[model samples]
Target: MNRSERRACRRLRVAGAGVAALLALSACSSSDSDSSAQLDSPASASAPDKLSGITVFAAASLKETFTTLGEQFEKEHPDTKVTFSFGGSDALAASITGGAPADVFASASPKTMKVVTDGGAAYGAPATFARNELEIATLPDNPDKIASLKDLTKSDLKVVLCDRAAPCGSATEKALDTARLKLTPASYEEDAKTALTKVVLKEADAAVVYKTDVKAAGDKVEGVDFPESAVAISGYPIALLKKSQNTVAAEAFIALVQSPAGQKILSRAGFLKP
Candidate 1:
């Protein structure tokens, strides 16, 4: 080959090699840029893995429904655990105000919930999630033939009612007042479950308690709905405690209780919608 032709071919080959090197360098630079960008991006960050435990102080009437919801919350958040303290709403409120460590408070009545709010123990305004009506819970087959509220007033019939301080008792009182009838219970129980237990254990012929408790008793007790119950429905309220250490988890639980899924569970447990 002639010198000029050979020189031109060598130059062309050199130029081709340089172009290949530049392309390779560009690709490497682009890849490095992408890696850096991803590292700096918030969207590429991993989710938090911290464990969260929440303590909930709920009313006796909410035991079944809240327990079901707590189980679901734990299942949805594998890193979370829910602990419950269930009892009379007024008592629970007193505990919270007395410096009990709790993340949430679910009360059976607005009056009890107000105890916490008025004490400034709540993080925010409480939300009413459910309502409960009064019912007469009697032994299986209702041997006492307790078909109405007045049946409880009949002499010689052993009847039990919640304490006036309790939400269930307060509701029962309102119901009796609505019917223009007065009742003298054999005893005043501390909570609805305790009141209902009187009939379940056959300790008393009948007990005025929340319908939810009666339903929860299954075949253990028969529920008698009175027309007066409409006027005595108790509103259930829930709120995050001001002293909550795990606010995130507590808020999530509150959201669950107010969600459609949670409402369905409460409804299935015989609780009314707020």
Candidate 2:
């Protein structure tokens, strides 16, 4: 089997006792047949993680890096299953406020996290785990010769930007304002990924998206760095929800995100330390 499948089978094996605990807490785990395959092994035989399943709601910009971190966390805590829900930070915050069941919420910006914290959906002080900034994502060849913030304002260039409600969009606006340049894009998307996708798909000539999104796109597009982006750096904050079913597991997941290993994964994905 491949690595991920082996890890999954290992998780199932390690989840012998966890299956019993999970059933007692909530009926949201593996099937009976899977659980029947293994009886409780001695704790000394193989020490498994205390947590069984951890669901996290994270910002869209965190998808690639968080997935890597989540898998690493599950490896460390073999009994735990980490599931993620990634979207615009604002949308995820709205869902949390609307009572969607989630253990952790990792927002792209502190302002979005405040939405849940203000509504009493979060339990403790949120930690700023990482930072990100905007960049110009253009076609592979960048035929238009787009270089800086001002280059986007060229009348012929078709540009896409994230909606102002999202962190990336707000950051883009700040950078534009910092450079004293005004831009009107062809369209406004919901998140940085969507904005970057427009450029990747050739639907738009360029887009203002997170540096991470541009990096995640790999050779699908090219990233253009500009000085004004420094004016709008966004802080990523993570917190445990107040209504979590397994507080211990949720807290442990948050701790891993702030750990050195997690930081390394994020840094490799073009994220900056908070």
Candidate 3:
């Protein structure tokens, strides 16, 4: 099915599922089974009663889906509130390690999560939650007649890329290297959203960004599939921070994201199964 069809079908299914067990899902790198099968309720079986709140630091690519997850989390645990800080996963990891007030960390790449895991900022080994791949996002129409990774090398094409420092940028580099192609970008964006925004805003002709970002952008952008994307897939990982004040609520939130409900929501957003 296409995007609209999938979204419509999900709405009908959610309408019937009720509010107490709200969540979403998407694709990624986990070897674990869908956790939602056993933890479908608003609160996990081990969740505490009347918890105050939980704060999550996640990748910018996860903003849309995680927002949905946050809302569903609040509904499931009415006593709890979910607040999020979304940006480049690497930056978010930096903030977490710098003593940012956050309960959980969800990163777009394992390399960024390593910044925390290596620093012993995380409570334990982070679990691979999902995976994402890069796609060429361009203006709604094929104005540039852009086709493959090689097409991006056109000197006349104004290409935007995520900075090599970010996960999306790193993935873009991998894809480019796989194709044995390199083209200078007009500008290097700080994050995937900004890179995509350039295409939507008509400031750039094309951008290499996360597939999920293009999916979230909807009609604002058009996505081009290329073979090299499979070679540079990004893995998403999530874990509780050592400074967590409410581990019960925090754990419940991560559990919900890893649950089937979370997976379905994420799948709708174009994220790959773990």
Candidate 4:
């Protein structure tokens, strides 16, 4: 073959080899791109579901109000199921300290909340959400003619008071002390709600409880306002627990309680906003 032809033949061969290599590289790249795309695509999106279940420990005085609030909250957040245990603030605090599986706690007094905070059992700062003032709860008919705080100290009134250990009881003590009166109650209840219950069931002629509690009791009891009650308002504080298994749910619940809707609900239930 001629030299030029030989040179041309070599060039053609080199160009043909280059085209084959390029084709092979393009095929490998296509395969890799397909594999990468598959890896990059998201698996699936999950629909938000209700938190399995959350346990809330709240003060006894919050029974009706919190129960109603819980029902409303559940309706608003279908993904969350709220359960509650309502008792004296001291008892609830003790339960939390005893390692009870509570996701949230609503206390009737800062003193009870202090117990939780001091023990390092709370997850965050407790927020005061509501205020409650003391009131004289009497039988539906007010048969005793009890008119004011001074009436409570009458030798024949037959009154029931919460134990001083309870928030309501302590607040009652403070109010009475502020008014310079000493009362000899027929019985000292373990909690305010219990004292009110005593009056409702005709076990006592009168009792001291939160204004909200009397309202919650409806016509079953008659509420008598005393000027001294203004001095012993109880602030309600709520907090999430540090060891809550449902931290996210607990936080969501707390947020709801602090929201305008929550406040409205509480207000409708006779709770004074903080």
Candidate 5:
């Protein structure tokens, strides 16, 4: 009876130990499975980028260079797009202050940018990215032998000037004041591009515009640098709008504009660095 009882007790103990070991293994397996699932969860993975696209309102004088930069930005981002509205800086500022849906604003003058900032449309302080100076765009050649700013005052010559509200026009007026000359334009274009177009199309013999505009026109018009232009230089400022739908993308574009590559593009287009 003693031997059989002892062996039976040992068998019971062995069976119970086996069951405990099996339960322990199952608990370890369950824990490891839970850990693996958590490691692969969406929360643990890297977050996706929030950048998509943005709309930019810029000065007409920046059309060419900004267009080039916009294309480059799209290419680099792949998932992003850049849309631009180029016009008079004052008009653009007015549009922004009027609640236009834009992600960014690049004004030809700090005064225009102030319009946006003062209206609470700007996200932060506008940064000056480049500068521009006045230039006289002639009809391909000096047909009237025009050499200086005063020569544009000839009554026989038809000259165009940007409207007084525009940055280009303001700069032109400053130049004229510096020269102490009083000359009326044949027409007042709303923007520098339009004023330059007048001469490019021969509608006017000459136009007072930004050097960048004259350069962007290529050989369509000849550029004349006057000493008074130095006093009439305008600074180009860029800022993110307060109503921007894509803040991340807008900031990135601003960074690109202030970057070395963007400055190089601006320089190629005859813009002065800030």
Candidate 6:
């Protein structure tokens, strides 16, 4: 009776041990499979690093040109993505000064670039890539017959000009002062492009804006060259930001903008190369 009972108890204990070992191994196998699955998944395998994304804050007038350049830059650097926030140069400068995470800053004027440089937001000395002059833009039909700067002084003409806070506005003021003409615009726009838009939309009879902006408007408006515009020339500046995380990419993009291809794009868009 003692031998049979002892043997049966030992056999039962051995069988229980085997089952426990199998269960442990099965759990380990399940965990390994899960890890393998995770590694093989497309999302985990192709996830991009945060540094691959770059943000640029540029002037509103550069919207078309920079957008084209951004697309080309992304194509050249497949792993990196370029994003932009285009606005008035003053506003863009203000954002960078206020600690916005911008990798690059391309301004429509040196005056605005100085705002960022003064704040120590630029990584290097800004480079002038292009020059622009002010033009009197009107509707395609020129219904109000805005022909020259002096015509802007007409009380009946609804003229639009950039705000005094913006580079275009400041340039306009300088040009007016040079021409000895005083203009009280119907509205002081936030940016050159906005002022141009007002005239293009037929909301205003005329606006003082960049020649590049007038060209950008295509058939929406007709541009009229004025002698006073010679007094004020806006210089476009490009620079890398000090707080940029992707310095390599930022430098590469800056180089691209200075390249011949970039110059062609800018030229075709009506920007005068410096």
How many residue pairs clash in all the candidates, one count each?
Answer: 0, 0, 23, 2, 0, 0
**Model 3 spans with C-alpha error above 4 angstroms:** 1-51
Model 5: residues with Cα > 4 Å off, grouped in runs: 1-51
Q: 1-274, model 5: which lDDT tens digit per residue? A: 6999999999999999999999999999999999888544423322226546789999999999999999999999889889999999999998888989998999999999999999988766899999988888999876888899999999999999999999988988888998999998899999999998889889999999998888888889999889999998999999988777777788889999999999999999999989
User: Poorest 10 consecutive residues of model 2 by lDDT?
Assistant: 39-48
TM-score of 2: 0.81
Question: In candidate 2, what are the lDDT values of residues 59-123, reduced to their tens digit?
Answer: 99999998998888888877788999999999999999999988899999999999999998987
lDDT for residue 168 in candidate 2, whole number 0-100 = 92
Instruction: State the C-alpha lDDT per candidate.
Output: 0.89, 0.88, 0.88, 0.86, 0.90, 0.87
Task: For residues 1-274, write the lDDT of model 6, one tens digit per residue.
Answer: 6999999999999999999999999999999999899654323432245568778898888899989999999999998999999889999999899999888899988989999999988866899988888888988977777788898899888999999988889899999999998888899999988898887678888898988899988889998898988879889999988767776687788888899999999999888888
Candidate 4: the clashing residue pairs are 50-79, 51-79
The TM-score obtained by model 3 is: 0.81
User: Can you write out model 4's per-residue Cα lDDT over 74-102, one digit (the tens) per residue?
Assistant: 88777778999988999899889888888
Candidate 6, residue 227: the lDDT equals 90
Model 2: CA > 4 A from native? 1-51
Expressed as tens digits, the lDDT of each residue in 1-274 for candidate 1 is 9999999999999999999999999999999999888655433322224536889999998888889999999999988899999999889999999999998999999999999999988866899999988888888998878899988899989999999999999988888998999998889999999888888888999999998999998999998889999999999999988767777788889999999999999999998999
Error of 1 at 113 (Å): 0.5
TM for candidate 4 is 0.80
What is the Cα-based lDDT of residue 163 in candidate 2? Answer: 94
RMSD of 5: 11.4
Model 1 alpha-carbon drift over 4 Å, by segment: 1-51
